[model samples]
Every structure is written in C-alpha cells, then in structure tokens.
Target: MAASVIELSDVSVVRDGNTILDSLSWQVADDQRWVILGPNGAGKTTLLQVASASIHPSHGSAEVLGSKLGAVDVFELRPRIGFASTAMARRIPRDETVLNSVMTAAYSVTGRWNEEYENLDVRRAQRVLAEWKLSALEDRKFGDLSDGEQKRVQIARAVMTDPELLLLDEPAASLDLGAREELLQLLSGYASAPSAPAIVMVTHHVEEIPAGFTHALLLADGAITAQGPVDEVITAENLGETFGLNLSVTRENGRFAARAA
Candidate 1:
C-alpha cells in the first residue's frame, strides 16, 4: 500500500471560542488526488493550511509525511509540501519577472535578490514553467500577466521545489469559462502524471474538478459531511447536504459537473 502523506486525527481549529474545524479526521495516501468541496466559511482553506504546515490545529493530532505537527521542524518540512493560494499570490511582488518568481520558490523566498542560483536550480525552474505552459511568459512581469497566466505561474512556482505534496486553494476561482477549462486541462495532465505528487485542491464548484482526481471530502460548517472515493462521495445526496441545496451531480470522461435538480 502507498504511504500516507497526510493524516489528521480528531483535528480541530478554534478561534475566539468558535471552531473552524471540528474533529476532522482524514488521510491522504501517496499519489492520490483529492478534492475538497465546501461552501464559504466551511474551513477548506484552513484544512489546506494545516496540510501545508502553515497552521497548527488547536486540538488533536495532524501529521504530514510522517512528521507530526508540533513535534517537528516546520521550516524543514515546508519545502516538501507545496502550497498555492490567492492570498499568497497577492503577497508576491508584482514587479518581479515570472521566471524570477518561480526560481525564488526553491529557496522559499519572494521578490528579487542579488543572490545567484545554481544552474540546476535555474533549469528546474524553467522546466516547471514549461510544464505549466508558462515558458512563453517567463520574462513578463508577474503583475502584468492575465489572471489565467498568473495562476499558472503561481502553480509552477509552488511545484518548482518538487514537493511531495501539492495543495491548491481554489485554483479555478475567478477564471472565465475558457480560462477555467484550460486550467482544468493542465491540472488533469498533472494529476495523471505517473510522477505527480499527492494533490489536494479546495474548490466550491464541481466543474472545476480535474479528470484524474481520485477521492473527495465535502465540508460544511467547519466539519466533514462526507468523504470517500470520488464516485461514492461526490454524489447528489452528499453535495446537497454539504451545500444545503438540491444538487444533481454528473460525471463524464472522469470529470464532474453539477446542477440544481
């Protein structure tokens, strides 16, 4: 069996006496692709943060790659876990070139510096950019790129370090139909790759799910409503409960779609 990459046992996140995540238990094994579906304020981003080691749960145990939270060096563990989010995107220097932005990820830094990177590091950055179809925009300023381009660049930057786990928070948010489709195709390719890392993506729209995702977790009110294999967990019954609405789900060519019943 594949090793577990992420594990949570009765994890809870409390803020000002309110629970953001309540006794959430989950496990993501190596090479598995997972989708986190939830409504606004459902703790999707919070779960991603815990997986990335950016946040510690207020209670319960959380582990990533055999390193338990609160008992390991997070700095050393961070590079092994890639994370991309809209909030982090806004923190990046817009004036920085896209290539430079990706290169800096190897060192977990943002913005330009006078330091020289090794040849291999530069090559890796370029390779990641090519993987994301952003090679043509390498010289463009990150701020000048279109939303879709920027999103791709950010993803390239996140994976430049060859992380064992990749967490994407709303990768398809704010994209137009064409751009979303393009991004979904790119994600599908990545997810299907034999060497792809374990992936967990948080998204509200079922249409944003890529073709190769294998499992799913549905959250509502800071708790898990359903979780299991994609076909079993991403049904109309589970989604309706998670989103508090009548939803009909359909699958085609390994991708998922949903509509009001």
Candidate 2:
C-alpha cells in the first residue's frame, strides 16, 4: 500500500473559547488529489493549515508524512509542503518580479535581493515558470500582473521546491470565465502528471474542481458532512447536507458541476 501522506485522528481546533473544528479523522494517501468543499467559516482553511503544519490541532493528533505534530521540526517539514493562498499572497512584496517571487520560495524569503543563487536552482525556477506558462512574465513585477497571472505565478512558486504535498486555497476565486477555464486546464495538466505531489484544493464552487481529483471532503459547522472517493462522496444528498441547500451534482469528463435540484 502507498504510505499515507496525511493522517488526522479525532482532531479538533478551538479559538477564543469557540470550537472551530470538532473532532475529525481523515487520511490521505500518497498521490491522491483531494478537494475540500465548504461554505465560508466551515474550517476548510484550518484543515489545510494543519496539513501544512502552519497550525496545530487543539485536540487529538495530526500526523504528516510519518511525522507527528508536536514531535517533529516544523521548519523542516514546511519546506516539503507547498501552500498557496490569498492570505499568503498578501505577504509577498508586490513589486517583486515574477521570477524572483518563485525563486524566493526556495529560501522562504519575501522579496528579491542581491544574494546569489546556485545555477541549477535558477534553472529549476525558470523551468517551473515555463511549465506554468509564465516564462514571458519573468521580468514583470508581481504587482503589475493580472489576478489570473498572479495566481499562476503563485502556484509556480509553491511548486518551486518540489514539495510532497500541495495545498491550494481557492485557486479559482477571483478569476473571470476565460481565466478560470485556463487555470483549470493548467491545474488539470498538473493533476495528471505522474510526478505531481498529493494535492488538496479548497473551493466553494464545484466548477473549480479539476479533471483528475480522486477524492473529496465536505465540511459544515466545523464537522465533516461526507468524505471518501469523489464519485461516492460528492452526491447531491451529501452536498445538500454540507451546504444546507438542495444541490444536484453531476460529473462530466471527470470534472464536477452542481445546480439546485
């Protein structure tokens, strides 16, 4: 069997006397692509934070890559997990060039500098940018790019280190129809790559799910509504329970779409 990349057992998170996540258990095996669907404030982001080792669960145990939280070096663990979110984007210097933005991820730096990088590292960064179709934007400042372009650049940066896990928070949130479609295509390509890492993407819209995602977890009221293989867990009944609305979900070409029943 493939090793489990992420395991959470009865995990819960509380903040300021309020419970944000109730006891939850989940396991993600190596090479699985998961989609986390939830309404706002359902703790989807919190779950990703735990998986990325950015936040510890307030109760129970969380294990990532055979290392349990509170028992391992988080700094070392963090470099092996790629994370991209709007919150993270706001922290990066807007004036930094696209290439520098990706290169800084290797060192977890925020901005460009005069320091030198190894020739191989530079080439690797360029290669990722090219793969993401951002080679032309290498010289462009991050602040000057469109929202879609920024998102692609951020994804490239996230993968710059060849992480074992990749977490994407709402990668399609601010995109227009054309941009969203383009991004989905890129994401689909990545999802099908044999060398791609395990992936978890958080999104409210079912349309944002890529073509090759294999599993799903739906959250509501800080609890899991349903979770398992995508074809079984993403039914209308489960989605309706998760979101508190009647929803009819359909799959086409390995992609999902939902509508009111």
lDDT of 2 by residue, 89-109 (tens): 887799999999999998888
User: 37-89 in candidate 1: lDDT tens per residue?
Assistant: 99999999999999999999999999999999999999999989889899889
Model 2: lowest-lDDT 10 consecutive positions: 108-117
Can you give the TM-score per candidate against the true fold?
Answer: 0.98, 0.98
* Full-model lDDT for every candidate: 0.93, 0.93
The lDDT of model 2 is 0.93
